[model samples]
Target chain A: MKRVLAVTAFTFRELIRSRLLFVWLISVIVLCGLDFLLSILSFGSTLQIFMDLGLAGMEISGLLVLLLGLAVTYTTEMDQKAIFLHLAKPLTRGEYLLGRILGFFLVNCLVVLGMGLVIVGLVVFLGGGTVPVLFYECVVFILLEMFVLTTLGLTYQMIATSMVGVVLYTFFTVFLGQCIGEVQWLLNQQLSHWVKVLLRVVYYILPNLEAFNLKDRLYDPNLVLGWAQWQDILLYAFSYSFVVFLIGWINLEKREFR
Target chain B: MERTAVVTDSPCAIQIRGLSKTYKTGFWFTPKVTHALKTVQLDVYENQAFGLMGLNGAGKTTLIKLVLGLLRPTAGSVAVLGGNISQRGVRQRIGYLPELPYFSKQHTGRELLGYFGSLHGLAGSALQHRVDEILDLVRMRSAAGLKVSGYSKGMLQRIGIGQALIGKPRLLICDEPMSGLDPVGYKEMRDIFIDLKKAGTTLFLNTHILDEVERVCDRVGILHEGVLKEVVPISKILESSVPVDYWIDVDGAEAAKLSGMPFQETVRNNGGVQVSGLVLAETLALLTARKAQVKGVRPLSSQVEAYFLKAIGAQAHLNRPIGGRRP
Candidate 1:
């Protein structure tokens, strides 16, 4: 347990020293700039458009940071052999993997919550409006989405032999995960038995990222953010993350660091 | 209370039996299995520097990885300090410095040591004190604040040794520890290894440099083509490799006078005759009788080169560079 925390602390310090915050700051600036530009260009209510884009900006930044973080740490841990320092210790491989996931999630939190704070702060001071409760809800859902993506991204890093492969696999998986709803839609329509079974298998295999994606439905009148919905979403995220984490652990166990 | 030291009765730091490693590469449909290490047998005794000499593709690194628990052996077993290498307590007392020691470039030397120390269950003042001590021991105290990326190769190697020593390990495993080091750096590292040996730390060095092995190792195991050819004590290697014949340069009349002597095999080149298999005292006595002016005496190392040639050239690889087939 002590060794696990030590690895976690070291990983966190490593990400910080890598100056990941610089990337976050730049992302936040670009996101805010785009929000400001789009809110003005669109003919809709400026406040509504800005708030909507700001919420999206939060998710985009979190996902972006998670993707970039996985790439950087993968190079460090695998390509540059930084993992030798960790694995050479008395720590187990599982503990090392968990520590890395937690550390990456923590950084994602910082970016997500940092961008959240920026959006909320800007809405309150600049836009002369009170922060809506829905924004915080969106942030929570975005964090949930990030939590699942973090495990999946790290798992991809564990399985991929190259940086380009890791990024492409994770990105395409994310795209496919979000399109699981479309697959379900196709399933509802007329389809062959084999096609239906394949789609169902893929649906169950890949995570439904859109479940935690609340930005699009923030303005929906019937959007449910009740305790029952919260319980289901949290359970799904934890379950998906655990499975991905297990896959990553298994892959890592079989890996030979030559 | 301190845990029971498992190494109390065991005389060997590392013990391997029929160890083999085959790496599966290429595509999934047609997997290619490359035998990195054949069923090889070797041991590294405690409190001695054991050098594993091999050519590039001779399974040196593969064996080291198996011992380090970074790779599972395809066959056989490896035990460190009388226990499996996977045992956490056992690993805590084993320090490893790889051939290409790449660290977190973002971390300073002190920070990197502290992180490694924390994993060994050290923290607060204990971690800091140990990091500082290691820094001083590796003579990197002044540059402890510099990020690892800014460090020179020598400095990186010093910090690598420092991290390995942070745990005060009973066994130190180094892969090519002195490769790429400058003369001064190499000398310093060799001196450090000697000091560690004096302190009773068992050292396992994987290297292809025979000269370094001859100088520092107490025992050497020659690995070639995944096979352990020989594990000889350093003293025995020196004795086996030492020259057996003596050559002398004498005046022409003196050489002619010495030609009939049973111990003298005369060399006609440069107006000097060669003497083979003559004891130094007897040759001097014979020279004194003949009124010979001794110009020079050269000791031939055909015996030593003979041993080396057999060990490395067993696979008919006399021309291959050290470590076997690596580019």
Candidate 2:
């Protein structure tokens, strides 16, 4: 446990010093600015459009931080061999993976939450609208989604030899995970039996990112986020994260640091 | 060409038997396996400064990584500190300084040590004191406050040693510890090795520096092409290599007589003379028998590099039957 905390703290500090947080701040500003401008240019309800884009802005910045975080750390840990100082010690491979995952999650949480607050403040003071309670719910779901992606990203870092390969694997996984819902709709179509089987397998295999896509349904009056729904979503996130974390741990143990 | 065992029954700090590593690359279906380390056997005992010498691509680093539990051995076992390398507590007791150590530039030397100390379950005052102690041991007390980016190559090496020493480990594995240091820096490192030895820390050093091995090591293990060629004591290697040449400063009157002797080179220097020869005792005895007053007798430097080269140089010593001779 102590080893995990130490790695967690050190990895967090490494991310901060790598200027990843600076990148996050810059992303928040640029993304929110782009959303604000696009909402005003559109003909629909500007306020609702802005809120929708703000949530989109949050997800974009959040995902961006995690993806970039994995790349930056992969370079430092593998290419630069900073991992020597850590893994050479008594810390177990599992603890090291867990700690790094936690570190990545914390940094991602900061990016999403920091942007959420800024957008909320902009809506209340300048956009002439009160921040809805549902917006916070969307933020919570976005946090959970970020958790899953971060774990998945780190899992790839364990298996991929090159930094570029790790990044590519993670980006493709995020794309497939985001497309699972649309593919589910296709699963119901009049496709061949084998195609449906393959689609069904892909749907079940990939994380159901749509389950945590609360931001897309924020304006839907029929949408509900009661205790039961929260339990299911959180349960799915934790179980999936646990499996990914285990895969990364086993790979790390098997890896030979040349 | 004979290799001698350390010849001690004491409990070993590190024990390896038939260790090998094969790295797999390429696509899953068509895999390429590179044999990084072949079957190698070595043993190092407590408080002994053992140096592992090898050239590039010679599996020196691979062996060290195996001991540190960073790489899994394909067909062997490694035990450190009377336990398996996989044992968690063994790592806490073993410090490592890797070749060309690179750390995060944002941390100061002190901060880096403190951070590593924390990983070893150190905290607060105990960690602080240990950090300070290692800093002083490596002579980095003044530079401890400076960021790692501001450090010179030598200072970086020192801090790398400092981090390794921070845990107060019983065994230290230093890989290529003297690869990039100047003369002064090497001297500093050499002194630290001696100090650590005196403090009862067993050291497992991997390097290509034969001079360093001669100076600081108790025993030396030469590895070539992923094979263990020989294990011999440093003191015996030095004792075995006959001095190539010896110089003697003699009196003026004895110069001409010394010049007439066979297998001796005599140079007239002012009123006196200096005689040189390949064998030290023969020349000294001849001079004394000839009634030449000997002013000084000094043996030349060591020939460790020669022995190391002869041991690992295309002799196929690794393929020779494993036999033991006393050093």
What are the chain B TM-scores of all models? Answer: 0.77, 0.77
State the fraction of real interface contacts model 2 keeps.
0.70
Chain A only TM-scores, each candidate in turn: 0.95, 0.95
Model 2 CAPRI quality: medium
Cα lDDT tens digits, model 1, B205-229, are 9987666776677877888889888
Q: List the residue pairs that clash in candidate 2.
A: none
The lDDT, on a scale of 0 to 1, for candidate 2 is: 0.83
Which lDDT tens digits does candidate 2 get at residues B186-290? 998988888788888999999987778888888999898898999988878888743333456677666675766655543454223223224557767877888
Residue runs of model 2 more than 4 Å from their true location after superposition: B1-7, B24-34, B242-301, B314-327
Model 1 Cα interface RMS deviation (Å): 1.1
lDDT of 1 by residue, A75-134 (tens): 888898878767878888888888888888888888889888887788788988776677
> Residue B292 of model 2: what lDDT?
83
DockQ of 1: 0.64
Off by over 4 Å in 1: B1-10, B27-32, B241-306, B314-327
**Candidate 1 clashes between residue pairs 3 or more apart in a chain or in different chains:** B55-B323, B55-B324, B56-B323, B56-B324, B57-B323, B241-B304, B267-B274
